[model samples]
Target chain A: MKKENISDAVIRRLPRYYRHLNELCSRGVVRISSHSLGQEMSITASQIRQDFSCFGEFGQQGYGYNVEELKAEIGHILGVDNDHHLIMIGVGNLGHALLQNFPFSQCGFTVDAAFDVSPAVIGTAVNGVPICSMSELDTFIQSHSVDVVVLTIPQTVAQDTADHLISLGVKGFWNFTNIELSSQVPDVQFENIHFADSLLTLSYRIANR
Target chain B: MKKENISDAVIRRLPRYYRHLNELCSRGVVRISSHSLGQEMSITASQIRQDFSCFGEFGQQGYGYNVEELKAEIGHILGVDNDHHLIMIGVGNLGHALLQNFPFSQCGFTVDAAFDVSPAVIGTAVNGVPICSMSELDTFIQSHSVDVVVLTIPQTVAQDTADHLISLGVKGFWNFTNIELSSQVPDVQFENIHFADSLLTLSYRIANR
Candidate 1:
């Protein structure tokens, strides 16, 4: 399967397809045509075929696609089977919430530990994930093969924290800090989540509508 | 301003521009050239100029852009001046975290109330925003100007909850449920936050690298 030359738009759509297929699998749906899947996802059938074709054909012309097989294939392409190790940088409100609720394991990642500056939460745990002091972060990352660092710290310290983590061999970042983190190091992936952006986008739609 | 023909890509960049301009304003930077701004944002100078052109001319030909003025103009275009009224549905971990930390007021939104089915939190408040029973939702929305609903509910009830909120006159949604909400009502806007998609994107990069 050719992964190179795939558009970012198609890569972004893979998770949506993975999610929708998960729902279909749970409901005992075995197979679906591009037209039926398109209707369910609100995407065009031809567009679905085109996207799937980017990763090699997962469907036959007449027999459609096997739901479970397609989901597993997409999951593999998304690296869900790799079991990436993750750590949270700030055990703040958002970080605490994510630790409590986010299905990280289901998405092929594990929270090895969390680090925070606050003394009150230093030894405590959220959803069984221990909150360690910031001083222990370097040692923890060195000992553990930490792949992604979840940044839920204040924007003022976000970049510095990320830089420090990157130096400790962290390869990816799931950033919740309002500020964007641009790593000077190559091969470091940053997925910055700007809640305000989503809010502003919604506001724009509401205002225009 | 010609808002009609503005592409979604440009709309998405408005918030980033707003954020960077804000950083500049806080630092007392008075003006910037499109080339410098583009460098800061990693976007091209011509692209920045073209995006701003979709709205209107907010810069001088040679003097560049007045930092505060351009930020304010972009803010206005993103409806940050509208003072949108917002409420949170499902006071779960994610919703609780948002209410406690999200800078809603900075983006021209006010959280009026939060709703949950749990009796333990029904009369409580997070960051002074009262948490009411879900039963009171209809009456509260009936009496107040609810512009948006923040959904952090379970995916199982996400669609029904959104439908009910839409029926009660909510025009916007900042949806955090794992499921996507497609409102049958016209003019309703949904900004679905899929954390898994972001995570998967990161994982893809890691695996491919």
Candidate 2:
């Protein structure tokens, strides 16, 4: 779809829009005006209209938007409708918790395998996803088509692990190592999740308030 | 500290700067120029200078910024030096993992307690933090000076739970409930963590690339 001039900010908002639409769909809401949707999401109606215009028109002048239709469109833009094979590195407390709790399938990601350096968790399984040893990672990636690698590994090894994964043809990364991972490879994409950053932001707000 | 007119974007970047400066301090790098810092962070040197100027004069014309001083100043701005007593709600897998793994004390947040509705985990503890029954939440908050509440609860009850906690005078929230928790209370601040958004962003880049 027309993604040429779309900003990263707009791309990030697509998921939020998709999520709201999913909620509306579940509630059996068929349609919504930009004004009402914007009010609920704390966004401006004009901004909402402008963001949607980057992809394509989903609403008429007075008819508003079809909830399911808008949701499907945004989901399509987010590539959430595509089947993605994902693997997790570092089956630590955080990794194990994610494997057990996160609804990865809802966003079209399936955790086919999880790799860990620990012998204790290597043969174990969390929610049917097998936890394999680090030694088998190369062979598994060679045999399986892994589209995304979840890096819950330590900060020291996160970059090296990501580089190795990139060499193995993995292009997407969901990194939780707190260190920002940047690759020299052009096609490699990383989304770093820093819990400390979020907490510090909250603390800043509280302190400033 | 001159906090007025500081934009949210600038506020968000404070933690990142704090983290980088922290690494520099640990590595015995006493000083750094904004150009070098900006290059490493992928931010413009002018933007870095502008963001730091919002707090105060951090670096001299040619002397550059003292690593320890900048880190401490940013930490103070982010309230990392304050002793914040944080209590976590919902001692599920995610909560358990966070309690076990997250270095909250580094950011001046201590997980004094965790609450769970489930009787199975009510009396247990994760990483020395006691898991209390949800029934005791009110009493616990009444007695303890809790500055922040970590919501790891289900989406269905997230808003209601936040409202209840707001009524109890808690103002800061680190929410992992997937749902956006908004409060009518003027002082309450929420930091929502959406793993799906990050994952979807990664997926979108992968698909679009």
Candidate 3:
């Protein structure tokens, strides 16, 4: 597989495969063909082959891919090979829940600090991740050199917070603000997880069905 | 937009455009050309025009689109024109937070019921939405015919829960589980929200930058 130029869509699906492979490995499945894996994912075998080929050839024609090896490879490709340091912005209900659950460090990403506007929550800690005031974002980010930010701010302040983070040299944002931020910051990537959008998509599928 | 045969990718982007337009409206922007909206989204004006054209011609060549009108049209296209009924599975930390925050009814979706395995949580109410045992899911779903199901279950039970929902004729799912589910029922749509994937994409972008 090539080390450069992976499509965003393909990159998005790597975790899906990695997770499935992990499950299969746990279930004692040692090998899988692109066809079977694609069947499980509802994608075409050829498409799976092409996506995998872009990274590097890990499967043999007749023998297929080794489940454990494929899981490790996909994990590395998805950049979960190393532990990541993350900070959460807006430690509200959603942020608090995310902080308490989803032990990312155990899975290769760590939430080291949390930020909020409320003084009440500022000094508290969720899951041992210290909650700090938004005023400390720049210093905390600079000192910790945080690699990713989980944005759980309100829709109104989403864009401004994103801009501020970008200016502070933050390269990636996991935005849960429900705001559509369309800025081109040279090396930064933003993933929008809009609750409304998710529900709407579900409604469409249900109505259509 | 056409009411039929809309691609899933296009459907997904409608909410994005809707949110973007909402922001513009809040800022007191009256109208926007497709070119400018496209630039904001990192897409081309013609592509934006084409997407809007699928439903109906909402823009003029010289005048562009009315901000409010376009927002309304997108809302309709995404089927958020009216309120939708939503149910939650796994009423744990994430589920509790979702119920308390992001009240979807305001945006056209309402959380009517929640299901969990915990006896302590069952028969309780979170933000007016009643929590029931998993055993009651089928009856509740049949009675209400919930339009969407939000799955915040653990990874191990994710697929089983999805299967249960689909068996009871669930059409759409907002899956927050780390596990990726492929639909066996063609009408059932599953949106896998991987927190890790977002972090990985951010890490990749940051590293590359």
Candidate 4:
């Protein structure tokens, strides 16, 4: 299927669909109608069918969808089958939580190493990924095949560090830095995780209440 | 302004506008036009005008929007003017990270207290927010008015814990337990922070490359 034809909303929902289907598969549910799936996801069955149709036919008439096959197709669509390498920057509390709890390898990315400026955390390792000094970052990127750099560093240095990484041919960033990046470098693909925006959205809900 | 008439998309963008305006304010930019604001936000000038117009007439025609006034209006609309109390239920690494870094008070939600089951971590205070025992959860809710609960525990007990909280009249949850909750509970607002979804979204972008 030509990706350019697919709307970003459909592409974003692909993961949610994959997640729901995986849950069903784990529960020994073999087949599920779009109507049932719709009820579960709070989206219309027609919408679900339309979304899946964007990637070619995967559902059967009357029989509905096969859980394993549908999930596998979505896994492929989400690039979970293809291995992606991630290098983490800043071994602070947030970084440490992500490095420990997030099953990166299962979801297509493997964190190869981490880098930190603080002397206290520089020589340590979190779950086998060694933390190196900032001096080693440029050389490490040059030597290793790093696909994405996960930034959880301070906002003060976030822009400079991101620009430096992008210059080293790194094309993807999972940025958590509060700098609202893309202000400096505008080229690469980025999934800017703005946690504050999410919090404020919730705050708005309370205020409205 | 009647918030009921506004779309969720507009409300979500409100926080983003607040953030951008805050930056301009910090830089001493007093007034800005829709055209310049749109250019900075990568949104259409007409779209920005439309969004702000939903919350009544705040923009002055021909002159432009006052940066400080616009931001303060958005902040008030988001309920940042009202104080919100939150109880964090799991003092794990993620919890600790939020406690140490996230300025919840600035966003209108104050971290009243934290609770944990780990013997090693219990009886500790993170940034002066005392950590209490799980036994205190029910009693604490009965005594104090907590607007939300931050969950960072294992998925296995997430639903049970959430059910327990909701039964105790807790209406909001900042869940990070990896469980897509909402089982047997109703009428509560939730902002599920699926960090994995954000990561997988980035992975898909990388794989598509």
Query: Best-fitting candidate, measured by DockQ?
Result: 2
Q: RMSD in Å for candidate 4, one decimal?
A: 2.5
**lDDT tens readout by residue for model 4, B4-50:** 75676787788889889999999999999999999998778999999
Q: Which 10 consecutive residues of model 4 chain A have the lowest summed lDDT?
A: A178-187
Indicate the residue-level lDDT of B19 in model 4. 88
Q: TM-score for chain A of every candidate model?
A: 0.95, 0.96, 0.92, 0.93
* Tens-digit lDDT string for candidate 3 (A1-209): 33677766777677678778888998999999999998877678998999888877899999999999999887776667667778899887788778876758645787888999999998988889999998888888778867778998887888988898888888778888766665677767777676766666666565555
- The digit string of per-residue lDDT tens for model 3 on B106-147 reads 567878889999999988899898999989888888888687
How far in Å is the alpha carbon of A207 misplaced in model 2? 1.3
Better of 1 and 4 by lDDT: 1
By TM-score, the candidates rank as: 4, 2, 1, 3
Using lDDT, rank the candidates from best to worst. Answer: 2, 1, 4, 3
Question: Second chain only: TM-score per model?
Answer: 0.96, 0.96, 0.91, 0.93
In candidate 4 the C-alpha lDDT for residue A32 amounts to 94
Error of 1 at B63 (Å): 5.9
Q: Scoring each candidate complex against the real one, what DockQ results?
A: 0.64, 0.68, 0.46, 0.63
Off by over 4 Å in 4: A5-7, A61-63, A183-186, B5-7, B33-36, B45-54, B60-64
Clashing pairs in 4: none
Show the lowest summed lDDT stretch of 10 residues, model 2 chain B: B2-11
